[model samples]
Target: MPTLEDEIRRLMADETARLHAAPDLAERVMRSSRSKRRRVRVAALATSVAVIAAAPIGYLTVGSVAMTGQEPTISVVPEPPPIDDTPPVPTEPPNLGDLGDGREFGHVRVGYLPERLQWSQRSVDNGDRYSITYNYKGDDKGSYRVQIHMYEEEAVQEVDDQIQAYRGEEDGEGVTVGARSGYLVVQNVGEDGMKGTPTLFLRMGDRQWAEIMFSPVYAEEFSSAEAVDAELKRIGEGLTSTM
Candidate 1:
């Protein structure tokens, strides 16, 4: 039979072995506490990240509306206005017919002048011929001038070769003055390279010939060579005989 001390010792050894081999309660408690603290820290970090990410979105939304009371909208570019392309109207010409009656240069009677031209002077050149001059204040400086000359002979003795001298052509292109046949000649007057002053040479009946000259420096009087030519044609067509 075992002694009582031996039984007591066996009981104590069994309890010690169970305590050593059993699950460690204190270590389990420490592990659970550490897990809980880790969960808390992870939750706080997630909350902080969410707040930081939302802050930019909130600031941008508020900033856009802070300046004006409205949110941002797309800008539109406006179209340009239309241009005006209408031409200006021309001015009306003044009436000047019947201005030549009672005025005589040699056997030629003054018949007409353009609206602005005024009679200036008259002189008898030689004994049987004469000239009548007209003046116009058409521009600021130089004046528009016209001169009508007549000769007793049927030929333009002084200017007979004028056409040949300038154009190297003879019996210049035929033109009509009133009811009579005439010739046209253009000659440069001044140093300016512009088209020359236009002159009309015509035979009047069998007794005389006439020359009419139109100076070209009338700045405002004529806009183009065609306009001046038209006026000259009108003047030539209006000439009449005094005799």
Candidate 2:
């Protein structure tokens, strides 16, 4: 008893198999709804009422493209640490190591220096084959640079074995500068702890010797290496070098 043109060709083959059509589109729409050609049965009942109103928006757009195949998880928040600005290391060392009756090279009389340093008036005498350099005020690479050399005998253990043949071990000591038994070597260290390069070898006589060089800026104010070996063992015990 189905014949409103067979219930409109079985409701256009169940709305063309609920919109997954195109497999021969429901047998070419049931052969154009068995047309005797009333404009092919009113264009197959207006293409089965537009495929039953687009089968619920084609099943909610294929269930919204299978629930967006997973992609929203973003929560990242990590980046905040860097501001040490560095400026604190003076636990005492600015009495200005007396440079008063000091400052002589050829006849050798090095009083002392280290703070506003001076004498980069630069000097070099051909007598004891002397050398003298001291800088800082206007910065001649100053953080402390005092190069005073006057050797004839030389050997506070050959200046600690020439800084142990250029640093094989590391630290060396024997201080008391002006009163003289100096030999604080340790050059170029910084493996990771950072601080080395003291070099002070003053002897003033087994034939007279002096070589004080300090410019690793005492690791910015002695923290270790035995507080830069007790601050270069009170340098030069007050050297009065005429030797």
RMSD of each: 24.9, 18.8
Task: Score each candidate by Cα lDDT.
Answer: 0.60, 0.57
lDDT of 1 by residue, 90-186 (tens): 9533322333532565567766787777765334355556666677554422243877777666345655565456456452466776678776766
Q: Name the top lDDT candidate.
A: 1
For candidate 2, which ten residues in a row score worst on lDDT? 58-67
State residue 61's C-alpha deviation in candidate 2, in Å: 99
lDDT of 2 by residue, 180-209 (tens): 566677666789965656766766767767
Clashing pairs in 1: none
* RMSD (Cα, Å) of model 1: 24.9
